[model samples]
Target: MDLLSIKDPRFLKDMNIEQLEKLSEEVRQFLIEKLSVTGGHIGPNLGVVELTIALHKVFTSPRDKIIWDVGHQSYVHKILTGRACEFDTLRQYKGLCGFPKRNESEHDVWETGHSSTSLSAAMGMAISRDLKNEKSYVLPVIGDGALTGGMALEALNHIGHEKKDMIVILNDNEMSIAPNVGALHNVLGQLRTAGKYNWVKDELEYLLKKIPAVGGKLASTAERVKDSLKYLFVSGMFFEELGFTYLGPVDGHNYEDLLENLHYAKKTSGPVLLHVITKKGKGYHPAESDKTGTWHGTGPYKIETGDFVKPKQAPPAWSSLVSETVRKLAREDDRIVAITPAMPVGSKLEGFASEFPDRMFDVGIAEQHATTVAAGIATQNMKPFLAIYSTFLQRAYDQVVHDICRQNLNVFIGIDRAGLVGADGETHQGVFDIAFLRHLPNLVLMMPKDENEGQHMVNTAVNYDDGPIALRFPRGNGYGVKMDEKLIQIPIGTWEVLKEGTDAVILTFGTTIPMCMEAAELLEKQGVSVRVVNARFIKPMDVEMLKSIFAEGLPILTVEEACLQGGFGSGVLEHAEEMGVYGHPIRRMGIPDRFIEHGNVDQLLEEIDLTSKAISEKITAMVPKKKQQRA
Candidate 1:
């Protein structure tokens, strides 16, 4: 019953129900064994085994396009589509990606990483199918947690209104990294109860219809009554109201039920939504019991006990440091409040939530709502810290521009993971915050050089009464710098000169600052004196110091853990140009135009030529050959 050994594409088609069920168990076991070593999404994948099997059994993939929303739940899909052998390299550099990558396989219809994108992508695919007169089924497996995203809702409205022929499978595990919230979860709960009643009603109507013409009207009446009861008792008419044929609160784990529903949906769809109820970690005991969202996605762990293999080095994470600092700050100021869009654990706001329960808010998966809500709170003279990942914040771009920035609200935007987020890859990188946030008027943006500086930046954001201030930090631990207890406010728009040199100046912030310092040290050994400056603030340029550096006419090398174009270096170039210092050659260093793939942070940096060795070599060569000093 080893499913991994079944290599034939036609193997699933020939399998009987009992064999398929065995295959589901085998797939779960395979995932557990592989993931324990590689460290991938454990719980979400375990839940979708049967659902994925039923999907492949019912519809032909490639011909029938399947778009997986958020893509974390696509591990089962990957395994079923013959990528099981490649899964050992999950989330590693130059290996299999954690999310669905279009280049990896034809079975993966769309390249998706962030939530709520499936519906929109599926809608487009469905429309294309219709236009081309193609008979392919467009199935988008979107989770209940993802449905909370505004874009998903927007697509739902459009698809329903347009009457697009597509199937939206609502994989309701009732979680998205964190436990789901808001009215949507409640609606799914009510639908689940109503689906239970459907079985009894269906049997009763069948018995009533057996009596011919006299009982025909009675059965019809009963059916109408049952429909009325559905509206009154069950809450899933939300999808029905939106013009979708609401099918079930079907058992997602039940292979036959999944196959049946999927077959039905494939045949009769003019926008059908199958509300599939599933446990996140269905078969796996450890993942099923996980409440902290720890097992959602992770590094290699022991399969038996579900514990991570001890990471060789134990440095305090940047997230924990930020969380602790917020908890400490909030104890003194009641005006201080914490807000995250369903990422209390990811943002490390668990400590803040424990300490200030009333003040902390997890605003579901609606980043837009979280931002506007922060703006509303800030309007009332409260300092609200809106903590969210950089890529996910793209969802709330309009809200940040309209609600907060337009009004110049005093909301503290704690843009976490603000650079190349390693293994999660291109879709999840925190590289665009500087490009997006810096352009907006009345916004102050800064990134910390180390953990200690991060604490100071957080304090500065809270204390500043002027306008909205953002403190962006990277994904992992800081460089083991001693954290300060007292909340010290570093001056905004100031750059700290780490190493002064005559050859060139390397300005950087966040995780890249450490790498820049290393480059400076190496260059110094080669007798190339390089100046290293931590340009903390992106919005407000360090005009005085920049002018002094420009006046020196040294080759200015700007380094950041952000996108090279329209980032910190671009900001510096803009300032230099405005000050008529454009004649000086400026070399900008950071992530390139291409989407960075899954890898360790160091390897990723090296791949992009952002490493200390690369930087030192590039700068050493860039420094002019100065007449050889007449030896």
Candidate 2:
């Protein structure tokens, strides 16, 4: 069975059980080989092999609408939908997307990258199907971890109340990046203990009803006894109360179990929750043994030895620097506490959690809850450091504004991955955080030039008692600059000049600082002096420095690795307008309005024209003809 020849999922219906099992093995081998080089959500995809196959076999996709929640597990779904040949260029620039794309195939009815969106999307699709009187099943596959997300719960409540004709596949692998948290995980744990829900529970209930015999004497008490059995067998009366007919804690890897339950779900009325248990990284040795979430999403790895092909002796990651600094500070201050939205491994908070287990908290999948929880902690005069990814912070915009900023609490937000996060693409790029948070009142947003400065900024943010402060750091390792033995607090709204010049100025911070330095060097060769300024504080920008620079009447070029509209550069322009320097020669360089796609950082930067060469070119064009004409 050549998997590359697989055009669509239609052929699955004709295949026998043995053939289907063989096909599943082939698909698994295909993914293991393909992802060793391309590197994707292998753990997630590996976990859903039989489940995904059974889905295609049980439901008609294009018309029926099998929507994936997070879309990371859709790699197997992709292979069955005529995308096996595109594996070579997966997640590359202009290549096959890592997530489900509606334009890619007719089978991909709903596109998603973020978690906990499928239930809502499926609910809408199910309603639309009913309105048109179409006889097609709507299935949404979601993880037990994602089930903890507020949006998923909201959709669950809505779907149950509406009684939509849909099937919800609760893919319980006991993990979402890190092993799940919250009370919901405990409920799923109990549900897992309660075996096959459909048959035993139904049979026992039928027997209990038959105990009444010919007359209706003991009927009411028998009905109450039958109802009480729900808590004992299914343990998922949780879903039943919400109006969904709860099914089995079925074996997701077993073909017979999956097919049998899936077939039964189609005949059922209202929303049905099919709890399917799976083993993440079922076949792979290294990934299967993983508990720290190392295998969730990875770089290229050696298939034979399972060794990651990462750069050797690289600088410490920005996440480590920031988290370690906070951990160090937490030692002295009793009020300091840490929180993350189920990204303890990603944010390198293991050290903090180990040292002070009670102080550190990992709130699973609920960014909105995490943000407000930090605010609530801050109100008690406790320092809550909420470490979250920039892209994910979009989900908690209201909490950040209404709860944190509006109330003027002292919350330290560690905004990780604050720029274009290469491989994960537009759905993950952190370009919009500056735009979103810059406008919020009583919020101080800042970035750093190097790891040394990053630590100091983290210290400053923790110590600062005026309103909420956020420190933004890029995804990968730092510049490997010599770390300062003593950390100091940088004054609020202060900018540092890295290189001085008279003709023009280039203002940038964080990852773009090195680019600005190189751009200054490039301009120096052409006899154009360009001053490089680390405009670290984005919100309350260094006003005194701006005044002096404006007084000198130098041409200005604001560079950032973020969106141009309402970003750091926009703040500079607005300041210039207020300072009566609107007519001065001003230029802005940053990411344009369009969303950037997957690729390496260098390629994505070059594609967006955010390179040193682009900066040099922009600065050269800004100033008058002052070319040295190298002799």
Candidate 3:
């Protein structure tokens, strides 16, 4: 059978282990070839090929819920669920999503992208099933790294306490984005090397039987000895103590082992934890050998040599610029420290970690903990720069509002990937940071127009001792702008006028600033002089500058690569209203109140009508014909 024609896993029900193994190989080859062109979570998908096959063979999907924790590893699940033929359009504009989409298939029971959510979602499904008097298994396949997340731990406590009949598959790959860290990771590590406990249990039971036929006290002592053996040999006893019927540290790649343990879990009553260990990036050589997590997710690469097809002479990545700047500042300032929520490589904090190992902390998959930790460090008069992606920051909203903003601590938040992140889609886009952060009092939120300004913003955030300051930088490479020899701190709430004109004023910042500039230049060709202002500061906005711009009575067009509601544009409107400045035709251009899907940055921007041509046309219409003639 053709791999592409494999619409569903119903075909696997009759196939033996040998046939399943062959199918797994075909699936892996398909993923490697498909993902090499489209680019995706290749490492995770590759690792789970066999495990996924085993799972589909045992359990019925759509009926028995299989919730993937982060959903990045759901590629194999997708392939088996009739999405194999749609691989060509994967992550492309208006095509198949990278993450699990509820609308995509009936098999995708729960949508996920952020880590540690599967347990809670599975619990909900279990409860719903129970309330409806339905009989179906609810299994959440969670990674070892994601197990450290506070929410996952919370869910574990609840699920154990509730004693619901559900199977929790702990996918112990020993990694999240980077290698797993902290105490929980250590616990899983101990479990991985503990070997099979069933053999030891059988041996102990036989030895205890040999000493039987001795009455009461002797029988009690034998029972105690059996219990003691569990503590000595079974690492899964930890989960047993949590009120869960713990299974094995099963070999995730072995079909026989997976099937056996899965069968055992099905037979067991109440909550059961099935621990399965597998290697991340299993089959592909480049991905398999990856120690630094570079191959976890990647772009187009050569299939033969396993080398990434490099684009011609790109500018410095935004992450590298911000993180490297932080590292540079940390050299002089002893108080400066860096923290990331499991993304050292993605955040480009590897240099900082290398330079200041003691000062850098990677609090694996715990965004809420990371935010508060930064706050705790700030209380001691030490500066902690919490580098986090914009989407993940949404998880730490309460911590930011209550701990950091309310306390007015001097914590520098480096908001990496601050706008449409492309390929990763709606779940990963950083569009909400501006709207979310701006609303919090005492939190200074800003973005830079270019990498040079980004360095200064980093300096500003570090230097600002008033309250919590956040610097948002977009994903991908910078504009290849010239750098300054000396770092200078720009004043808070200050706007820079990039190009001056009298017809209309274009207020924008960060990635949108380039678009505004280009639009302004194009408008100049059309005999319409447009002023472009870099409204970098989103919160505590440049009020004085805004007042001056409105005083000129020039039609104002505010643009941002963020949501229109409660965003930079809305901020401008609120200020205009507060100052009693009315009758000035103000137009706002930004992301609409809808989730933008996965695609390239250019495609996404164009889809949202955020291109230079769109901006120029809007600005031309906004400016009066009389004003155009004067210019």
lDDT of each: 0.85, 0.92, 0.91
Model 1 residue 554 lDDT?
A: 89
Ranking by lDDT: 2, 3, 1
Better of 1 and 3 by TM-score: 3
TM-score of every candidate: 0.95, 0.98, 0.97
Tens digit per residue, CA lDDT, model 1, 256-374: 78888787777775999988989998888889988878889888888788779865676778877777787788888999999999999989998898878999999888899999999
Which candidate comes out best when scored by lDDT? 2
Q: Backbone collision count in every prediction?
A: 0, 0, 0
Off by over 4 Å in 1: 1-9, 197-226, 627-631
* Model 2 lDDT tens row, 1-631: 8888989999999988899899888998998899999999999999999999999998887878999998999999999989999999889888899998877899988887789999999999999999998899999999998999999999999999999899999999999999999898999998899877668777877788657465575777777777777776756578889999988899998999999999999889999999999988878998889898899888889999999999999999999999999999999998999999999999999999999999999999999999999999999999999999999999999999999999999999999999999888879999999999999999999999999999999999999999999999999999889988998999999999999987899989888988899989988988888899999999789999999999988999999999999999899989988988868888899999998988888999999999999999888888877443431
Error of 3 at 156 (Å): 0.5
